[model samples]
Target: MHKEKQQNIKALFPPRPEEPQESDCCGSGCSPCVFDIYHLQLLEWKKQCSDILCNAGCYSKTSDGETNEPLLSPIKFSPFQLLSVQQHTHNTFLYLFQAVRANSEPDQESAVTEYTYVKRPLGISVGQHLVMRCSSDGNQNTVVTRAYTPISDLRASNVGQFEVLIKLYENGKMSKYIQNMKKNDIVEWRGPCGNFTYMPNSCRHLLMFCAGTGIAPMYPIAKSVTENDLDDTFVHLLFACRCFEDILLRNEMQQLSLYWNFSAEIFLSQVESTAESQTRYGECVKKGRIDKGVVIERLAGKTLQQVSILICGTKSFNKDMINYVKHVGVPDDNIHLF
Candidate 1:
């Protein structure tokens, strides 16, 4: 992920191949010298570069047959209308939106000007995010923005719409704003953020560790890998939530596993397995927290070189999982934090 920042900074402001030698220091008892100034500038450059990426779009051919250009420019946030909203869980809602470009008038050559509204083209990928901007006081300039990854497969059918799964929380600015939105309400959006990319057959097996709503990005990843149908590809997901009710996309995941080599284990920290959960969830449900015993048993004979683990959760979940994996002799390079 940091690679993009480094590349952008170097392209815009090239860094010195090597630091200045002792003889070139030119000491003048200055409080902060040229090197210090350069370091500060580099930090600023990184921030700016990250913002640019947050608003960048994917490379794809547009309606006009142009390639290698963003379908939506990063110069401005595009307007998208809320086509529909559905409650996915107790607190999570799925918002579907259609892109409506400003000044999108029909060509003069066409006699019939059809104004049918369709889903807008996103030109985004599986793991990329969309930055949504809205206002609480109805002030456009003083707006608040939030980043959300689309759980929909945009490239699967090149549809004009996308779906985002958002969880509502008390005192949550963005969530509250989106939840209260009515049908056809226009929301400002921009994107294709994040640097995680999934390629087919990239690894022998993919291990995903996510907790709570952190499963957002993992959904698209597992979907993409399974849809690709690579012969040697396999996926294992260790998802931890508070209880069975908190588990999101359970039906969709189970449906996918019916035809793909995908397996998921749901761990609950607050409840023990009951007869109801056992009958409903079967072997997928487990009590207590994810531990070394679980990890080791699942990864018994799997080759480390061919396995890559993705970690996404709260700060503590990430730290604890990383430490636990390290304790089991897994190399630092095999574990990735998202």
Candidate 2:
């Protein structure tokens, strides 16, 4: 492994600062102990570590089920300023940021010119993520950063801005910080991360299985495939969530469905009480999760070599889908976990 990749694996989770022991807790009841909160953060960190390693091929296995050499490469980050923040759903927010280019002038006087402040367009692929870093003013020493994939199509008419859909958890520190951010706030970010690159006509069909915020990354891939006229690629999305309200980008998904070869199946784990069996939940929606029956039916006549399966969700969800697809004869190389 390269030095940077080695360092990344070692530095997956920075050492946590020591906290007062549970024994020292006061008699007053606390809904969630500090230790408990830390534990949740640790779980997320561990999952991210595994994802990074897997994408870098640290844990990739061959057809014979043997470990293979790891691939390593470093990504660069840059700073960008927040332009707008719009609410997507009850808990989800859409963030728009304009890129900030580095100063290239020889003197301070020339640097002040308006032309010197030209914004650099974010260079990102169809299925990549960005690492965002933010620090609270009260505790500037403690910085909280997280990885989020932008859902907007940067290759479209929008040139100077990019958008990200973030679902804020009640106790999530980074989410709270972002919620209070004002316009013109500078956020340090780096990116174009992830191993799955969508090449035009790379596969006859792209099948994506994702849940919750996992749809953020899946959006770009689906949009690109449907919009690219040069490539007659087919896009299939198997998206699941607890309710229709929790759906991230319903309008965007509807637009993509207008394309001839685009197909999507929205699965709801808990359908609303008012929704009847005959009621339309919009285009391509179902009442349960995507199972073997749906997969086999959708991919009926296609060869395993012509189909690429992309999955992103909780650890258990990813594991279950991967196992099922593998049992159905999909090659290991054709399945990507994100």
User: What TM-score, computed on C-alpha atoms, does each candidate reach?
Assistant: 0.73, 0.70
> What is the alpha-carbon lDDT for the whole of candidate 2?
0.70
Q: List per-prediction Cα lDDT, in the order shown.
A: 0.70, 0.70
lDDT of 1 by residue, 287-327 (tens): 88888788777677886645778888899999888877777
The positional error of residue 77 in candidate 1, measured at the CA in angstroms, is 1.8
lDDT of 1: 0.70
Q: Which ten residues in a row have the lowest lDDT in candidate 1?
A: 52-61
Best by lDDT: 2
Please provide the root mean square deviation of candidate 2 (C-alpha atoms, Å).
Answer: 16.6
In model 1, the runs with Cα more than 4 Å from the true position are 1-68, 73-75, 103-121, 140-142, 155-157, 277-283
What pairs collide in candidate 2? 77-190
| Tens digits of lDDT, candidate 2, 159-239 | 435788999999998988888988777777776678666654556888999999989889888887776565578888999
